[model samples]
Target: MSAVELNPRPVRVSPLIKFTRWSLLGLGILYGAFHHNRFSKIENARREKEEAERPAREARLAAEKKRASEAEIKYLGELMTTNK
Candidate 1:
């Protein structure tokens, strides 16, 4: 076999295929960027809401604890008086 025939010829890709491949790549990148940005915004909003509610939730829990303690004390006092 001759040297020219020994080497494989380079494959030629069609312009339309190349264009479609690049377009798909570009659209994929754009979609990923948009979705990432949107996801970050949603995560930030959720974190902010959690931070905002934390204090209120703590205060409510403290109030409930206090009320329970008061009720227990009243019950104990009544029991002592009745026993006397």
Candidate 2:
């Protein structure tokens, strides 16, 4: 009986296949980074918008308070004048 020798050959990949694989990987990384940058920009814009609106909200509240005080003063003046 003759001893059989088994040698496994190394598989060769084509250059085009390797290039396509690397290109796909690069595109995936770029896509993820692009979305990450976009997300940060959106978060920053939201924060800025909130900051900008805060002063307007405070001003509106202040104006409302001033109007209420003016109305109360006018009523008191009218009552005093009528009683005189």
Candidate 3:
């Protein structure tokens, strides 16, 4: 007997199977594109809302910090007066 076999060809795929595979791939591409656009629009809207609120948030934080500083100064001054 020889070392190698006589038949070495690969089997052929059917045309219908090929068509189904290509159509599924195209559908998946379309689904991904739609979801991508939708999510990006939602994210953009959120970013715009945050930008609109930024200045007001900063002002509120600054006011809180100033109040805390004044309270601390008043407390220390009262303590000094009691000690003397």
**Model 3 Cα lDDT, one tens digit per residue, 6-49:** 98687798999999999999999999999999999999999999
Local accuracy by lDDT, each model: 0.98, 0.96, 0.97
Model 1 ranges with Cα > 4 A deviation: 1-9, 56-84
Our tally of clashes for model 1 stands at 0
TM-score of each: 0.54, 0.44, 0.61
- Evaluate model 3: give its TM-score: 0.61
Backbone clashes, candidate 3: 0
Q: lDDT score of model 2?
A: 0.96
Worst 10 residues of 3 by lDDT: 1-10
Runs in model 3 deviating more than 4 A are: 1-9, 65-84
